[model samples]
Target: MPTTTQLVISGQSKPGVMAQVASVLASAGVNIKAFSAPEVTGTGKLRLLVADLEGARAALRGAKIRFAEETALVLSLENKPGALNEVADLLTQARINIKCGYCTPSREGKRAIVVLTVSNTEKALSVLRDQSLDEF
Candidate 1:
């Protein structure tokens, strides 16, 4: 399995917060590959997968933004019904709990790219590899 770095930014849920963060990253020439942002009450957190990790880190630090980075597994799965269910089933059987997950479809719409943060990443990776799954 392959892993990618995800940057999580924590801030208030007010308007323009995400835009500000995006602007900062863009100014540093960092491109975001995928992202998830959900708000609860007045607080929000943005999880981002970027093309340039170092640049993102530098930009965030220079801007004094509150953020953290984590390694997340990236899975490429067929874009069809039950695709996510199949992967979730495998993780459940392996006793791996998914902490966070997000996905996007490929340009041609034939495959889906899933990013997951699991309680046991190494074990999950081992299980997926052993099952011979196609990156899902």
Candidate 2:
């Protein structure tokens, strides 16, 4: 049940905006472990899991980039179909709602690290831990 802080950035969608944001993080020496940015209509949002949280915050502040922060659960699941479905079912049974989530292949390619922002952090952690989903 490892928890990490995710930076959320929202603004109008424009060419080079993501590049600018990336530059800011890079300049601040914040390593981006994962990210999800999607554009809809004329706006977009960027969610980033950065290694250096404080550095990322400072950089965003210095760049006048308004952002929000949220706690995210990081889980490593087997790289197979229905892996996420199983986790989702567990959370659903616990009456927890998933706000957003994304997955990326692990370095070894044998597993996937799923980052999830759920409605109930404590409950989600407890449920996952109780189910031995944290073995990874």
Candidate 3:
């Protein structure tokens, strides 16, 4: 299985927080591939997969943004019923907890990419890689 580093940013939620972060990355010529931002109770969290990890890190550091980088499993699964459930079950059976996850919208006759942050990245990757999913 292949794994990629994902940046997780958490801070007090406020207007323009995401904009500022993106601006910093963009100024550094970093391209964001996948992103998710969810805010609750004045706190916000952002997760992103960047085309240039080093550049993004530098930009974040230059902007004084605190973030954590972790290994994430990216799976390309068939766009069909029970696809996600199968992955979830595989993780559950291994006692691996999913810390955070999101999937791209599935299109007809196409596969969907699911990005998962698991409690045990190596184990999850091993398990998923062993499966017959479209790709891991």
Looking at model 3, residue 41 earns an lDDT score of: 76
Question: Candidate 2 regions off by >4 Å?
Answer: none
Worst 10 residues of 1 by lDDT: 127-136
Ranking by TM-score: 2, 1, 3
Tens digits of per-residue lDDT for model 2, 11-63: 88888878999999999988998999865778788899998898999999999
The candidate scoring highest on TM-score is: 2
Instruction: Write one digit per residue (lDDT tens) for candidate 1, span 1-45.
Output: 698889998888898888999999999999988999965767777
Number of backbone clashes in candidate 1:
0
What's model 1's lDDT at 116? 95
Better of 1 and 3 by lDDT: 1
Per-residue lDDT of 119 in model 3: 95
In candidate 3, what residue range of length 10 has the lowest lDDT sum? 127-136
Model 3 misses residue 91 by how many Å? 0.6
Taking the tens digit of each residue's C-alpha lDDT, what string does model 3 give over 34-116? Answer: 99786587777799999999999999999999999889888888788998999999999999999888889555657878898
Which ranges in model 3 have alpha carbons more than 4 Å from their true place?
A: 106-109
